[model samples]
Target: MIGIVYITAGSMENASEIARELVVRRLAACVNMFPTFSIYRWEEKVEEQNEIVLLVKTDSSRLDEIIGTVKHLHTYSLPAIEFWEVKGEEEYLDWVHVNSS
Candidate 1:
């Protein structure tokens, strides 16, 4: 099974750092980062902010390790980490499975 993990970082630097580490550790096959605007309720107040979003590709089996690494390296008290099962081209999914292992 392939998983697409979504993580929001405070800045581009943080996003890049996380992406690099994940790839280096073979926990993620690829990570795409982009600027995004996020709006959500926190502490009973609605807040909006600019953030960097990371789209991470990996095998579902690696999800736990990926989440742990992100939590360890993340600066936020509560970072956004979410994932969902994904279906992609066979070759690509196979590549992800191989690399993520």
Candidate 2:
């Protein structure tokens, strides 16, 4: 199992849209969305804003397909998408593998 983190705009509508697509397509076992704050510079202008963060759980082998789909569907030209290798207790990992598969 693998845990993927994605940062999207603060819009619930956008988060919901992404969540639905990933889950329905079986690319993700579960997606957890929570509020987050982001500070960055764009187009030579600095900006600070609240954002929605998504924690997507899926099988490790499916990461590429999922990423490709996101790149194709994401509104932003360079969406912040990353994956964290989940190295933890065996039981939890097993559960994630089961659920994602």
| RMSD of each predicted structure | 0.7, 1.9
lDDT (Cα, tens digit) per residue for candidate 2, span 1-101: 56665647457677778777888888887889988888999889998988788888777887887788777777678778888877777877666667666
Query: What is the alpha-carbon RMSD of candidate 2 to the true structure?
Result: 1.9
lDDT of 1 by residue, 12-91 (tens): 99999999999999999999999999999999999999999999999989989998999999988899999989987999
Inter-residue clash pairs, candidate 1 = none
**What TM-score does structure 2 among the candidates reach?**
0.82
Question: For this target, which candidate reaches the highest TM-score against the unseen true structure?
Answer: 1
Residue 1 displacement (Å), model 2? 5.2
- Angstrom error of the Cα, residue 74, model 2: value is 1.9
Scored by Cα lDDT, where does model 1 land? 0.94
